[model samples]
Each structure stands twice: as C-alpha cells, then as structure tokens.
Target: MKEQTLPIIDTDVHHSPDKKEVLAHMPKALAARGLALPGGNGFGNPHGVNRRDATPPGGGEACSDPAYTLEHHFVPNQIRYGILHPAGLLAAGVSADYRYAAALCSAYNDYMLESWLSFDPRYVGAILVAPNWPEAAAREIRRLGGRPEFREIIMTSASESPLGREQYWPIYEAACEMGLPVAVHPGAEGNGISNRPYAGMPSSYFEWHTSLSQNYMGQIASLAIEGVFNQFPELKFVAIEGGIAWLPHLLWRLDKNWKALRELTPWLTEPPSELIRRHVRLTTQPIEEPEKPEHLLQIFDMIHAEETLMFSSDYPHWDGDDPRFVLPRKLDEAARKRIFYDNAAELYGLPPQESTVSEEAANSATPTN
Candidate 1:
C-alpha cells in the first residue's frame, strides 16, 4: 500500500498435501481404506488441479513443503503473513463414517500444525473440520482452535446441505467461542456430501468452475435467511476463492428479496444485505478481470471494497493472482492498503507487526498515470 512495497497478508493461499503424506499420519485401518484429495470424489477432474508453474522446483506439488513455499511465495513476494488453507483433503466433508471423517480431519490438522504452522512464524492455519459430523467437528475445533498457529476454522464450501441449517450450528458455535473466523472455500463439489453446482451437476469442469460463486451465493443467503448472523452475533465468515465482483449483485438481490419476504424470516429483523455487510468478508482470487480496468474499481466501490474484501493469491494454483499486478495499478492508496493487507490482518487477528502498514507512505506515493 506504500510507494515502497507493503507487507501483504494473503488470506487464501492453498496447501495441497499428498494422500501418502496425510495417510502416514492416520491409523493403519484408516490408511488402508485409502483417500484422495478434494477435487474429485472418484471421478477424474477433467481439468488439471493446479498450475504446472506452481509446482515447487524441488518438486512434489505446489505447497507440498514449507521451505519451497517460502522460497517461492513469502520470501520473494514481501508477504508478512499468509493464512494456509488446506482445502484439498477436506473431502472428509463427504465421508460416510463420521468417525473416519473426524479422524482424517484431525490427522490432517496435526500434519498441518507440525509440518507448516510450527515450522514457520509467518504462516498460520485454518483448522479443517468435517462439518458432516458436527459434534466431532466441534471437538476438533475446540481441540486445535485455541492454538496460536490456527487463526480460523475451515470447511468445504460445497456441503451436503446449506451450511446455515441447524445441524451446522455446533461448528459455528465452536469458531465463535474460540474467537476464530469461519472460512468456507469452494471445492470438493459433487462428492455425495456436498452439493454440485446449482441446477444439478454441470457437464464440464469449466461450467462447474464458473458456477462456484453460485454456491457461495446460496450459502450466504441460507445463512442470512436462517438468521445465522442473529444467532451467532460474534461469528465472522469469509468466502474464499470466490471472486468479489459478484458480491454487489448478490447484496442487491438479497435486499430486494428481503423487503418483499421479511415475513418469511422474522428473525432476520434487518435487511439481509446489512447482515452480510456486517458479518461476511470475501477473498479476492480468481478475480473477475474485466475488459476495462476502470470498471473493476466501480465494482469494488459498489461492494464497499475497503470494509468487505481482502486479497488472496490462491498461491501454487494455476489461477493465483500476483499481488503486484492482481489489483488495479492505479487504485487509490486507502483501497489498496485495505485489500492487500489491513482487512485480512484485522480479520485474522494478526499482530501489529504484520498487520500495520505505512499509510503516510501510501498517501505520499506518486500517482500512476
């Protein structure tokens, strides 16, 4: 956010653990059953899962090693803090055996703690819990949620039922009690436990990928209509890997619908959009780049970008946006600082050293032509 490089707090960097790595931590019985990452239940992903370029030079997959990730992302990019999202293995959200699901999630969290969080001061984790088993998930959250290394609780965005349903309340309760935000990421689609993209399964990966925002839209609406914000006033939710452009449209539709249907959800005493503004935040990745760059700024303004949006590189993934170039080059300083650093800093409870930016430097920087 400064004329000089500002420290970035990336909210949606992904870490894809190999099956063997995770299974090595699980019980033999569980390991024998076998597991694959979240991109598919069994069906092959028609499209590749990550960028070839993102694979570490040392080679495994993108995000396989803390050392490789540091060399590739944090050290070179001037990132002060990164929230590690391990969404790939969260297919546990679809596991039939709640015990197995719980075990897998717990083991994965342990692996993340030892392998990533403990290994690096700059990196923090989102405790992945299987929402399919709310009680066990809550236990998992309570178990690991208090650790300084884990700043949030994460679950698959595409779940068997809309996340706002009463059954998921336990998980939300645990996050709120621990004072950690809930980050729902879009992946693991069509995996029995999670819904496929809207209007039944799409025929192609492209269609499936493009419709991810619809899933977030449904989740946001469900949470708002069901009074989740009212029920858990302290809860904060972040929609990860979902681009920010759709937010204004969603809020607009929600407000109009709520005015007409307020009687349907009396508990949502205020407008649905208002609740979303107060309680929800979104990550910027897979950003919806427009033909005209200036139009991007208008969308941000419409969505109150400073208050609601945060930047995420979605690192090691093909679509990862470079911090230097991802945002509009001529963005005003205040908007740039909040999107790149401050919003995520406050949301994730980052220390002042990582969260604070030099606003004077940003303000004084020469404007781009």
Candidate 2:
C-alpha cells in the first residue's frame, strides 16, 4: 500500500502492542505479583493477543510483523476502515502473562496517545479498564483523560458486579467526569468479563456473539431499572464492534419491562427508553451481514434514534468486513457520510479529514465518467 490507502476511521483495529513497553513501567513489587501477558491468560476473545494464540510471539516480534498489525489485514483488502482497538489487546500482547491486564492497559493508552493517535489524530483508541477493579479502572481513566488521543474507555462485559449494581458507580462517574464515552464490546477476559454461561444449552461462536451485547443490555437495563442512569446523566456509552440491529428490540423489551416493574425502583424519574436514547450510541460494523431493503435504515428511526448509529470496522479480524461492502445500499448520502466517516469523527474528536486520502478508496472505486 502507499500513502493514500488509509481506512475510514475504523474503530476496531486489533493491535498496537508493547510488552516490555508496559511491564517495565510497573514497579517491581506490582510486576512480581502478576505475570506479563500475550500468552495463555487472554486466549480466544475477539481481540485475543496475537492473531493465533497457539503460535504466540513476543510483543516486538508480533507488532513488528505486518501480519499482526492492522495494515496487513486492512490495507491489502482495499477498505478504508481506520483501526480501533481495546487497550487490553495491547496489554495482553505486550505482557507475557496476564498479571497486569489493568496496568498494561494503562501503559498502552499512553503509548497510543503518544504514538498511534499521533500516527494520525484521526486514528482513535478504546482504552481498556477492568470495571471489576473500579478504583484501578478509575485511576487509568483519569490518567488517560489527560491525553487528547485516548478518547474512550474499553472493558469486557465480564465485570465483578453486574453492571447495574452500585459497585460499578466509580467507573461510571469517572467516565462522566472525564467527558469520555465508555466503549463496551463483548469479548473475553480471564476474569474481567465472560460470555460463556456454562448452562445446559450448547454454545457456538454465533451464540456467544449474540449474547455479548446481552451482557451490556443487562447492565444498561439494570442501570436504568435500578436508576443508575438517573444519577449519572452525563455518561455517554458506546457499544463496540456490535451491529445495532438488535438494539431496537432490546429497547422495546426494556420499555415493556419498565412499564411492568417501574414501581420497584422509586428513584427513577423517566421512562427507560428516554435514558437509552439520550446516553447510549452504537457502532455499525460487522453490520448484521447483508445490507437489505430500504426500510432497514428506519429501524432505529422507530425508536427515535437515527443519529446514534456510528460505524466501525472490526479491523484485522478475519471476519471484519470492508466499509464499501458494509455500507447500506439505501443509506442516504448524509447517513453514509456519518456512518462511514462523521459519527466516529465526532465520537473520538477527530478532525473533518486527515492528511491521508484513503488510497484504498481511490483504488477501489472506478473513476466517474
């Protein structure tokens, strides 16, 4: 690829790692308590360390090689999806053991702010945090907010407490104060968040993928049902890598539940959908596969949320699709401009356009007559 072939602000590129880069930052005392990462700890989640964990490479070896970076996967495909990644992938990639999932996550945010975001500010990040360890997570958020490039916080759905519980309040409060959105994508962690239910039902990748956002749905609904959202009005939550097709349904179910159970939570002042409509937005990537009939675009319109759908390319993943292929056929020019470009621009504080002109876009589209 050459200078022009940049991806659209792909909010889901997989790695920007530095193992020793972060392990070294921790004091010997803390480092000793934990093993470094990129090994067994982070096994098979979406952004698992190294493309294939069975064949793990050191941070330097992994990131130095094109196969492990966004450029290798995205550039050749002729897609203009700029990379976005959870800070945890970097932490796990940089450390040999998972001991410092939280710390390495912090270090990677620093590296990204100083490096990747500067690699081009249009480049954005989803800094990882462990909500189970709210104080630790809060510390990282405060540290990261100081940097302009580290725009949001990323966490696994696997928190120690259910998201609706008050225990996670610090995480919510810190995010609200920092003026950053929390990017919650469903993925794995040794303990932070888990998709597996270990129930009687047999599980498949599709099953887990569907449930990923369910975890958030639980949290958000709980937060609203339990009145957490009422207290933290400023919080803006972004769902990563998940398509929004299921959201309208989730909102409908939530609204129905509130009508049935509103009396249980005395503190809540407004309807559940109002909270959802105001504070949450979702990325429109891996967009439920086929872009269908014209009415598909109006699904959110029914819920009064046409503007909340942002776009993301789950970059570097084998299944991550090209933006040209993902964009809906009926998406108006304005919606296309936002989903393909502007929504993310506003979300991550990116400029209207970057210096790179998306050579991939230029090459892929035939010249207009």
Candidate 3:
C-alpha cells in the first residue's frame, strides 16, 4: 500500500483554547484572578514552537482554529482520527494552587468539548486533569469521560511526586470506571511549582528536550514497580511525545531489579516488562533515528512495537513527524499498519476502516497474544 493510502490515527495533535474563551468557562471569581495555565520552565526554544506554515489564515494561534486545522492538517494528511491534546494546558498539572489548577483543567475540557470536538467528527480529545488534586481530577474525568469525543485523561509529566502514588489512584479509578486511558504528556518538566528535572536543570532547550525521556522513565518505573497495573488491570497509561528508544533499556533494568526485589512488590506478580506490555502504550513522534536504520528496527522489536506503539503527529509543533516519512520505509507493512492506525484505533475504540480490513484480518488470524 502507498503511504498516502494508509489509514492514520494521529494520537497527539495539539490545539489550544483562546485564553478569553477558556476564562469564560471558569467561575467568575477564579477567572478574575487572571491565572493562566502554567508555562514551561525558563529554557526557551530558539526556534518558535509551531511550524511556520501552521498559523491559520485568519491570524490566530497555529491550532486554535478547528476548521483551519482540519483543512490544513487532518484532511491533507488523510488522518482518520486526530486526538486533540491541549497545548496551553499541558503544564496545568504543575500549578502551585491545586484548586486553580483543577478549575483550569475543568475549564479547558469544557472549551474543547464546545469549541473543537463539536466542530468536527474526526476530532477526539484527551480529558485534561490536574495531577495535584486527584479527587478533583477524578471528578472531572467522571464528568466528561462519557463524552464520545473524550477518549483519554491527560496530565503533565512534571509533578511533585511520581504518578503511581496512592494519591493518584483516585484519578486512575475514575478513568477505569469510565473506560478511559490515562496519558502523560511532556511540557511541564522543571516548570512552575512542579519538581525540577531529575538531573537538576539543563542549561539549554536542546539539553532539556533531549532529557525529556528521563521523566517518562521515572514515571513508567514508578507505575510499574508501585504496582499500579496490579490494582487497575483495565487501566492503560500512554506516554505521549516521549521518544521510544529508551524503553528497551528501561524495561530491561526494571525486570532485572524486580528479579532481585520481587519480595518488596508482592503485588507485581509478573515481570515489570510484562505488565508494561499489557498496560502501557507509547506514541511515535520525535522518534529516535539511529545512524543505521536497522538499529531502530531492532529497538522496536525489543519493545514489542506491534502491541505497545502508536503513531502521533504532535501536529502544529515544530518537531512533529510526518506520517509519510516518520518510520523507516523498510519497516514491514503489517507493522506499519499497526503503528499508523490499528494500535491507536484499538486503544481509542475506533472502528476499523475498509482500507485496513485486509491487514486487520491477517493480524487477527495470527494474534500477537
């Protein structure tokens, strides 16, 4: 199949609500405080965040206009589904004032539902929740999780504590009850009131961006070693925009440590790698490109890419991937199909497209399990 002909489900397309619009959804008192969503730490991108061509013709933010995004991004790319992650609220989880953070997240969800989701059938959203206030976050999940357009719950990776602590169990429970996957997206690390990067602060954006994967490693290890999967078997955790290459090493180290320390985590009946394979999913953007293309393929195989990986454009961002050229051309067609569409479709409960029926049938006949 030609690259253009393949069905695509972009799992990390970003869209931001107009600040005035989001404020309107908030309680008047909270809105009056004039608190905006927390921006990232001081390291500035030398190049701007959005692609030069992404700005809407009407002169607004890159993805702030749904109609413009559909025409310029989804339709042109033939994306069957575009999972909207709010760019502005990516750091909301790290806000110092927990009540304001929760209120801001709730407001963002309302803005997405009314402004973006209703505007297009292809647009689905991740429910933004404040990590600091898990009970309030759970309430937000319960409030909007039933909406067909909201498929997952999202929070920033930057947090005062790792995500697997019991405080976050309330949010996970609500997501499980609503059958929504919980996702962590980067942008908040070393930002606002959240904890600084594990290696202290980086001196440049280049250093910081390269080190983003460290945050994912810590969170994934915490979630696995802390037995989050054991408590919530139905839960799926997505690490979005975090590169995939480090996963093999992380999983290997986790399994190695667990072997010696299994008694400490009795709830983890199986290896950490096994639990991660079952409960965690990752997106492909800023995918690591090794000098030898085959080396990247080896990493994919090591991590069981067919089951755990999904495609994401990170649309409108400066470093977003293009569906036509992101993965190596030499990758197997069946695996490409799974990465581009099948895996995400299954995770988000989207129906199979006629274009992919043949691949789906072949895959089902030889199930990965």
TM-score of each predicted structure versus truth: 0.91, 0.76, 0.94
For each candidate, what is the lDDT?
0.80, 0.59, 0.85
Candidate 1: tens digits of C-alpha lDDT, residues 1-369: 533276688898887766676778889998888774445534434556676766777778767777667666775676777898874676778766777888888888888776777666677788988888999999988998889989999888878889899999999899899999998887777875577668888777677778888888889989988889999999999999888888888889989988898888889788888889989998889889999999998988888888999989888776788888888877888888888888988888886543343443222222111
In lDDT terms, which candidate is top? 3
Among the numbered candidates, top TM-score falls to 3
* TM-score leaderboard ranking: 3, 1, 2
- The per-residue C-alpha lDDT of model 2 at residue 247 equals 73
lDDT by residue for model 2 over 163-211, one digit each (tens)? Answer: 7687778888888888888777655522323333324222445455555
For residues 177-294, what per-residue lDDT tens digits would candidate 3 score against the true structure?
9999999998888877777886899888899889999999999999998889999999999999999999999989999998999999999888899999999999999899899999
lDDT-superior candidate, 2 or 3: 3
Better of 2 and 3 by TM-score: 3
Instruction: State the local distance difference test value for candidate 2.
Output: 0.59
